[model samples]
Target: MTSKNRDLRHLHEFDAERLITLGRAVIETETAAIAALAPRIDAEFARACRFLLNCQGRTVVLGMGKSGHIGGKIAATLASTGTPAFFVHPGEASHGDLGMITPDDVVLALSNSGETDEIVALLPVIKRLGVPLIAMTGKPRSTLAQAADVSLDISVDKEACPLGLAPTSSTTATLAMGDAVAIALLEAREFSAEDFALSHPGGTLGRRLLLHVSNIMHTGDEMPVVTETTTLREALLEMTRKGLGTTAVVDADNRVAGVFTDGDLRRTLDAGIDVRSAPIAEVMTRQCKTTRAEALAVEALSLMEDHKINALLVVDDQQKLIGVLNMHDLLRSGVV
Candidate 1:
């Protein structure tokens, strides 16, 4: 058998109950580790947040091994959450990428043992340049912590690994601590949702926040509109021409008076109304739902859901007809 098949057979030796126990043990261990970190967000954690907040230059994250992987994610989270930050591998730092560090920048070094040679080697230079150092280490007394201006301890009671050799619980704790720091800074800055959306312009939140009704609403001739004195047949023709499933009926001032929809047509026919000869105002539903052209498309969506509607007429402050938007418009614009 191939090596992969042999590995699969070995994995099959452990039944469902054994697998569940193993998975649960790891989850419980990590859960406890994260829970323990709550109490440790003490004065030192506040100090770390203050340092990052005051940083005029970007926060440079440094790490080695598994800590490096976690540090990269921490840097990304910080950058995306209004704190400008980036990651630099310690091994690469020793090999001349150290030039990326500037006096204006703050260094956040990560090491579970706090004694990784490459990270430790950069300490003297970091100090020489007067760069503030924030160390996240399991060992508070180790070299990295001693060299830092602010040391936020990420100590864990035990590893989730069965052998207690792999970095599991400790890494999870460090990641949680990093998130806590980034979020604290984000709140301190009072970072607005618009500011956050600016940073994530390609994300779903950006689409929802940046896209306004004016950008997607059907305007001018594309909007289905008719006068209240118009015949029901003419309104139906207008609805068919615009293909919006509905048409707005306007009064003498050209402002919306009511709406004539497919549902109105059905009820009108059942009541034996002569659609070809009856005025639209006689059978249309008055006080129809409407939206402003300046509103967000997401707000329009909420209006649709709250009122169980699929479309809305866009109006101005004076209640004058301006445009029309439907669920299809939102979907087409990637706002839904």
Candidate 2:
């Protein structure tokens, strides 16, 4: 016998064919559970969405054990998407955590057996406070279902676990249903991507969605600048002072005439020109790429990418210089 077959036989006492059949059954049960949930999204789901959308306070998600863990995740999803929500442990709710829930909040309770002692212990408090309760349970006829304002039937024909003790298929169905509720409310609220980005300011999505060029561009005296008539030596002094590796060459009006960067300086040095007295405008890039102050930082990134450069000047509509932006700015802003 193969080593794999021997190992399987030791614990399961089953042939390879039987193990394969069991795995297939587990997958099928969960698949069927999801498909069944699709048709049930008509009225009750709409009611739940409306309740959550109009909730005057945060949505309080509560569950016990494995369901509690799933509740925590669902709470996070709801909070970041648009709705304000948080998870409270059912066991804690009976002691003092019930204070975290308020009259204006909506309660989403999860229980597989629908009679989990910890979950049942909080029902009276939820009722006394008159917080609308949505119960997600396998047994709709159980105590929790009867007490709930809306009962979401997450019943699976059977668990994938052969012993029928583990909470696998049922939990998946419940979590899927929870996600459905959150997304439905999100759509009804007309929540924008920018609103979601504000909630996730620490992530890459926030960088892309919330960031604008004005936030990262260097302004005031920090920007390297020299008059167009200024010598290459004067321009180099400004670049060194700002340490931005580039200097703007401006006309008499302070409008950008050209740009001289470290790259241009290097080529000028290679040509062995008179760096001391040469006018910067003679050597500066006359057609340097620029960005507007109000542009998205993402747009600045695209401009840099398409032009294969590292820095850009921020300008106003009348062609006046406002700020300078570089790849390091993009890096610091999490826009890179």
Model 1 ranges with Cα > 4 A deviation? 1-9
lDDT of 1 at 270: 98
| Local accuracy of candidate 1 as per-residue lDDT tens digits, 311-336 | 89999988999999988999988888
Taking all chains together, each candidate's TM-score versus the true structure is: 0.95, 0.84
Q: Supply the global lDDT for candidate 2.
A: 0.90
On TM-score, the candidate that comes out on top is 1
* Candidate 2 weakest ten by summed lDDT: 6-15
* Collision count for each candidate, in order: 0, 0
In candidate 1, position 30 carries an lDDT of 99
Candidate 1 whole-model C-alpha lDDT, 0 to 1: 0.93
Candidate 2 residue 260 Cα shift, in angstroms, is 2.3
